[model samples]
Target: MAALILDPLAALGRATLAACRTIGDVTLFALEAVSHLVRPPFYGRLFWRAFVEIAWFSLPVVALTAVFTGMVLALQSYTGFARFNAQSTIASVVVISLTRELGPVLAALMVAGRIGASFAAEIGTMRVTDQIDALTTLSTNPMKYLVAPRLLAAVIALPLLVLVADVLGVMGGWLIGTYKLGFVSAAYLKSTFDYLEADDVISGLVKAAVFGFVIALMGTWCGYRSKGGAQGVGGATTTAVVTSSILILALDYVLTEAFFAQ
Candidate 1:
């Protein structure tokens, strides 16, 4: 009995240590990449490429997700508030929910699944195929060349995507409210504008920036450390998406507490 208890304790201890080590490694990697951002020999071409890939290529999916989410949220809000005869509040709730929580969180999650996996696969493939070695041998810092540009791009791109998401999401709510819910368009728009504060939008944007950084950091770190072969790259891609998504959710709560806790 004692042996069994001790064994489980040991296993838990080992897992804890492994998790701590991973956190430290990722922190160091992120610091190195951020340092590259301030250092010279910037790779503007690579940065632009990453920006387009992350921002432009990602727009359609994010927009669709946002719009549908908004429409659904409005419908759900109407259903709930109708019981209390508070249907007039649906527009304000939609705006606040989208700008404060749904827009940023949903957009980041989508990007995490897309850009995070792509980053990990691309870099992990390069790592396994010796392409990363070639860059280092050629005196090109792989971190700067491979990681920094993508990191900067994600940090910048996600906020733009979230901003667009917020707009589209609100529009979706408006469409549903006016067409299906028998709401007056002018009144709904007025309610949306009136209840929306700059702080709500700003808080969401700040959350987007942080989520973006986390997404890129996890992607690059997993890719940079990937080993083995094709299997390893595939594993890294999955890990990047999973870790970024988890971090986005955890950080979202922390950020919400910081912004709104009284």
Candidate 2:
């Protein structure tokens, strides 16, 4: 009986220790990547490539997601508010929801699924194929070359995507409200602008930047550490997507509280 109890406790302890170790390792990795940003020999070409890949290439999907989300949000908000004779509030609801929450969260989740997996697969493949070692042999810093540029690109790109998402999402809601729901276009537009605040949009953009950092950090970390072979790369890709998605959600709550909670 004592042995059984001790075994469970030991397992828990080991898991806890492993979690702490992983956190510490990631923190160190992030610090190293950040340190490279301020150093000489910046990789402008690589940063531009990463920025374009992250921001421009990812725009279409993010746009689609935001538009549909706004349409659905307007419909749902109208449904719930109709009972209370609060239909006029739907515009504010749609705008606020998209800018303060959905825009950043959904955009980040999409990017995490797309770019995070891509980063992991690309870097993990390099690691397994010894290309990372080749970089070292060539007197190149892998962290500076491979990680820092991506991190900077993500931080800058995600906010731009979220900004576009906020606009498209609001437009979607406008379409649904004015066309399908029999709302006056002028009144709806007025309501949207009246209740919307700069802070709402600013908070979402801030959240986007942080989520971008977390996504890039996880993707690069998983990829850089991946080993074994193609299987390892596959695992890292999956792990990067899953971990970044979870972190995006968790951080969303923390940021929301920070920005809005009294």
TM-score for each model: 0.99, 0.99
| Best prediction by lDDT | 2
How well does model 2 score by local distance difference test? 0.97
Candidate 1 lDDT over residue span 1-262, tens digit each: 8998999999999999999999999989999999999998999999999999999999999999999999999999999999999999999999999999999999999999999999999999999999999999999999999999999999999989999999999999999999999999999999999999999999999999999999999998999999999999999999999999999999999999999999
Query: lDDT of each prediction vs. the true structure?
Result: 0.96, 0.97
lDDT of 2 at 239: 98
RMSD of each: 0.8, 0.6
